[model samples]
Target: MTKEIEIEAKNIVTKDEFVHLCSSFQLKKQDFHVQHNHYFDTAHFDLKEKQSALRIREKQHKFVLTLKQPHEVGKLETHQSIDKQTMDHTLATGIIPNGDVANQLRELGVTTNTFTLLGTLTTSRAEIDYKGGTLVFDESSYLSIVDYELEYEGEEEEKVETTFGALLKEFNIPKRDTDNKIARFFKAKAEQS
Candidate 1:
């Protein structure tokens, strides 16, 4: 298990803006890869109510369970690696494995067993190093909805904001409020229901 503080700035973009950014950044088709995020929550969204989220991310045949919670500077992320069998069992039984992530949820008053598979969101993503941060371009699809986003993840909040802002200005992309993938997925799920 590993823990980290995730500080990032992000904005939603239009399809045309997404393409334009790709062109400006010289991101080729091969630069992109696909990842699947399987979100989980209790029936009443207990975790969501606490401003926390849990997910098992599958990338390149590997799975990592992560729990994100509110923190002073940014979201605190706890990650634990799991195998395919574990992933399947959790999805089928709504039981999380014994690990730091589960422990963190328990600390947040969220029982591990209460979680059920909410849904999955798949994204075609590309990343590049820019201004001492990782700049990400994502086109994600979930529940018949597709969206584009640009994110800058870095250690320093001020740098992340300034760098991300400059990039948007450079490309003439408008700055719009953007929810993280899990939140967006939850919103889409609610709309569908």
Candidate 2:
């Protein structure tokens, strides 16, 4: 297992803005890749109540189980690599593996067994190095909803905000409030229900 502090600034953008950013950054077709995020939560959305989230991300034929919890500067992310078999078993049975991620959840007063598959969000994403941070472009679809987002991830929160803000201004894009992907997925799931 590995842990990190994730500090990022994000904004929702229009499809036209997404395309414009791609062109301005010189992002090629090959820079884009697709990934699927399968979210998990209890029947009562206990994790959401705690401002935490859990998911197994499938990318490049590999799987990773991650738990994101609140932190002072940003979210604390705990990641555990799992094989395809483990991912499949958890998806089919709602039984998370006993490991660091589960241990972390336990600290949040959540039992691993209580989690069930919530839903999946798939995104076509591309990342580029910009202003000492990683700038990400995402076109994500979940539960009949599709959206575009721009994100800047970096070690320095203030710099991330400044750089991201400047980028939007340069592109003539308005700054819009953007919820994280997991929250958006849960909201969409709830609306459908």
Best by lDDT: 2
After superposition, the stretches of candidate 2 with alpha carbons farther than 4 Å from their true spots are none
**All candidates: CA RMSD (Å):** 0.9, 0.9
Per-residue lDDT over 137-162 for candidate 2, one digit per residue giving the tens place of the 0 to 100 score:
99999998999999999999999999
Residue ranges of candidate 1 with Cα displaced over 4 Å? none
C-alpha TM-scores of all predictions: 0.97, 0.98
Report the lDDT tens digits of candidate 1 across residue range 1-193: 8999999999999999999889989999999999999999998889999998899999999999999999999899999999999999998988889989878888899874657799899999999998888999999999999999999999988888898899889888888988899999888887878
Clashing pairs in 2: none
lDDT of 2 at 43: 79
- List the global CA lDDT of all models: 0.91, 0.92
